[model samples]
Structure formats: C-alpha cells, structure tokens
Target chain A: MSSELLFAVVGALIFTLGVAGTVLVANLLRRILAFNLMGSGAFLVLVGLAQRGGESDPVPHAMVLTGIVVAVAATALALALLRKQHEMKDSEEELTEIDDG
Target chain B: MSATLAFDLLLSTALVWSAWRTITANRLDQAVVMFIVFGLLMTLAWCRLRAPDIALAEAAIGAGLTGALLLDALGALRKGKTARRRQ
Candidate 1:
C-alpha cells in the first residue's frame, strides 16, 4: 500500500479515537486535549489526501496549515473559559457551604 | 520498502500513541507533556507530507505556543485552591 493510503487509514482511526476520548472524559482540560487530537488527525488525513492528489494541489495543505493554527488558538480560548467556569463554581459552592454552616 | 514510507509509519504510530496517552494519563502534568510531544510529532508529520511551511507553523505556533499556554493553565489550575472541585 502507498504511504498516502496508510496515512488515511491511521488518520481515520486516530480521529475516531480522539472523538471518543473527548466524549468520555469529564474534565474540561482533557476534553480540550482531545479536541486538539481530533484536529490533528483530520489534518493528517487532509494532507494524505492532498498527497494522493499529486504534487500540484497545494490548496489542501494550505488549508490544513491554517486549521492547525486556528485550532491552537481556539484551545487557548476554551481553556480560559474553563478556568473562569471553575472559579465561578467554586465561589458559589463556598458561599453555599458557609451559609449552611 | 522505501525509506520515506517506513519513516511515516514510525512517525504516525508514535504520534497516535502519544496523543492517546495524553488524554488518558493519570497525572495532569504527564498528560500535558505527552500532548506537547504529540504536537511536535505532528510537526514532523507535516514536513514529511511535503509541507515545509506547515511544519514551521506547527513547530512554532502549534507545539511551542500551545505547550506554553497549557503549562500556564496547568499552573493556574494547581495554584488556585479557592475553588477546588468536589469530585
């Protein structure tokens, strides 16, 4: 089999695994990590597809590259939101606990 | 087998494993480290895919920047004791 085909197979498997991980993991951080994994796996498949298309198709490669950077930025932003949510939940719990006491 | 194909197989295997572990690691620290390695491996994969520009962007933006951001977030999670989760 060709390298491109190998990559497509592996990439699809990895992408499925990543999606499962994201769904199974309760922690927000782990979810973010899984999302990145899913993004990378998709990118890999896209690159492989581009390779199979031959040397002239730079479009897919360029798009995938853009996607990689965008994914990281989105991850960063989501992490910040998760942090905020954690802080807010903690404060509310503490307030309730103190009131009960 | 051609050398490039062999190398791609090795890289894809390593990357898939590392990324899988990054999500499942018991320790958050270890998970973050594995994720960083996974990112670097992805950069290598981009290069092998005949996209040098993507390789550079992945190395600098995806791996380096993302790792730093993750480490910072990890520290925040550790240092903030005021809002510990009940679970």
Candidate 2:
C-alpha cells in the first residue's frame, strides 16, 4: 500500500481507539488524555490526506498548527478547572468532617 | 520491504501500543507517562509522513507542554488524596 494509505488506516484506528477511551474511561483526567489522543488522530488523518497529491499541501499543515495551539489551550483550561474542582471537594469534605466532630 | 517501510511499520506499532497502554493504565501517572510516549511516537510518525511542522509542534506542544500539564494535575490530585488520608 502507498504510505499515505497506510498512514490513513492507522490514523483511523487511532481515532477509533481514542473515541473508545474517551467514552469508557471513568477518570476525568483520563478522558482528557483520550480527547487529546482523538485530536492527534484527526490531525494525522489530515496530514495523510495532505500527502495525497504529488506535492504536499500547505493548507492542512496550517490547520493542524492552529489545532495544536487550540488543543493545548483547551487542555490547560480543563486542567485548571479540574484542580479547582478538587480544591472545592477537599474543602467541602473538611467542613463536613468538622461539622460531624 | 524497504527500510523506510519497515521503520514506518515499527513506528505505527509503537504508537498503537503506547496509546492503548495510556488508555488502560491503572495509575493516572502511568497513563500520563504513556500518553507522553505516545505523543513522541506521534512526532516520529509525523516526521515519516514528511510533516516537519507538525513534528515540531507535536514534540513541543503535544508531548512537552501536555505532559507537564498532566503531571502538574496529577501532583495536585495526589497531594489532595494524601492530605485527606492524613486527616
């Protein structure tokens, strides 16, 4: 098979695995990791498609670059939210313990 | 098979394996490390695919930045858990 085709197939499989992980994993952090995996898979497919013609296409490359930046920003925001949630939960638990005591 | 093709096969195998391990690892730390490895392998895949721009972004942003973020989050979670246990 052509390299493009090979990469495309692997990319699809990766994307599928990412989707499964996102859906099945219970932990919020794991779900975030899975979502990133899904994004990478999608980027790979786009790159693979960019290689279809004789010359490489620049449009997909530009798009993937933008995607990478956006993904990182999103991940940072998600992690911050998770940390906030954890802090709230911990404080709530402490309050409950004090009340019971 | 040509050497390049052989390399591609190996890289793809590693990518899938690491991705799977990242998803299924019991500990969040293990999963984060595996995900970082997966990201690095993805950079290699991008290189083989002749997308140097992506390879660079994947290395710097995907693996480096993301790994740091995950590790930081994991640290916070661990500290909270330990504090709760102590209390």
Candidate 3:
C-alpha cells in the first residue's frame, strides 16, 4: 500500500481510540490527553491527504501548525481549570473538618 | 517490504500501542508518560509523511509543552490527594 493510504488508515484508528478514551475515561487529565490524541490523529489524516498529489501540499502543513498551537493553549487552560477546581475542593474539605472539630 | 515501509509499519504499531497504554494506564503518571512517548512517535510519523513542519511542531508543542503541562497538573493533583489523606 502507498504511504498515504497507510497513514490514513492508522490515523483513523488513532482517532477512534482517542474518542473512546475521551468518552470513557474518568480522570480529567486523561481525558485531556485523549483529546489531544484525537487532534493529532486528525492532523495526521489531513497531512496524509495533502500527500495525494505528486508534490506535497503546503496548506495542510500550515493548518497543522496552527492546530498544534491551539491545542497547546486549550490544554493549558483546561489544566488551570482543573487545578483551580482541586484547590476549591481541598479548601472545602478543610472547612468541613474544622467545623466538625 | 522495503526498509522505509518497514520502518513506517513499526512506527505505526508503536503509535497505536502507546496510545492504548496512555488511555488505559492505572496511574495518571504512567498515562502521561505514555502520552509523551506517543507524541514523540507521532513526530517520527510526521517526518515519514513528509511533513517536517508538523514534525517540528509535534516535538516542541505536542511532546514538550504538553508533557510539561500534564506533569505539572499531576503534581498538583497528587498534592491535593495527599493533603486530603493527611487530614
């Protein structure tokens, strides 16, 4: 099989796996990781398609770079939110403990 | 198969395995490590796909930045869990 076809098939499988992980995993961090995986898989498929012609296309490469940046920013935001949520929970638990004492 | 095709197949298998492990790992730390490995393998895959720009981005952003973020988040999570246990 051609390299492009191979990449497309693997990319689809990776995408599917990522989707399942995102839906099924309980941990917030794991879910975020899975989401990134999904994004990468999609990028791979796009790059694969871009290779169909005799010469490699530049559009998909540029798009994937933009996507990588966006993905990193989103991940940073998600992690910050998670940290904030955990801090809130810890404080709440401490307050309850003090009230009980 | 030729050497390049053989290498591609190997990289693809590694990618799938790492992704599976990352998702299913029992510990968050293990999962994060697997994800980093997966990201690096993806960088290789991008190179094979003739997308060097993506390969560079995958290395710097996908693996480096993302791994740092995940590790930092994991640290915060562990601290919280430990504090709860102590109390």
* Candidate 3 structure quality by residue, lDDT tens digits, B6-86: 888888899999999999999889999999999999999888888898899999999999999999899989999998999
Q: Which is the better candidate, 1 or 3, if ranked by TM-score? A: 3
In model 3, what is the error at residue A7, expressed in angstroms? 1.2
Measured as a fraction from 0 to 1, the native contacts recovered by model 3 come to 0.79
- Could you report the DockQ of all the candidates, in the order they appear? 0.61, 0.81, 0.84
The CAPRI-style docking tier of model 2 reads: high
lDDT (Cα, tens digit) per residue for candidate 3, span A8-101? 7788888999999999999888999999889888988888877855367899899989999999999999999999989998999999999999
Clashing pairs in 1: none
Model number with the top DockQ: 3
TM-score of 3: 0.96
Please list the residue runs of candidate 3 whose C-alpha ends up more than 4 Å from where it truly belongs after superposition: none
Scored on chain A only, each candidate's TM-score is 0.89, 0.94, 0.94
Stretch of 10 with least lDDT, candidate 2 chain B: B1-10
Scanning candidate 2 chain A in windows of ten residues, the lowest lDDT window is: A49-58
Taking all chains together, the TM-score of candidate 2 against the true structure is 0.96
lDDT scores in order:
0.83, 0.89, 0.90
TM-score of chain B of each: 0.88, 0.96, 0.96
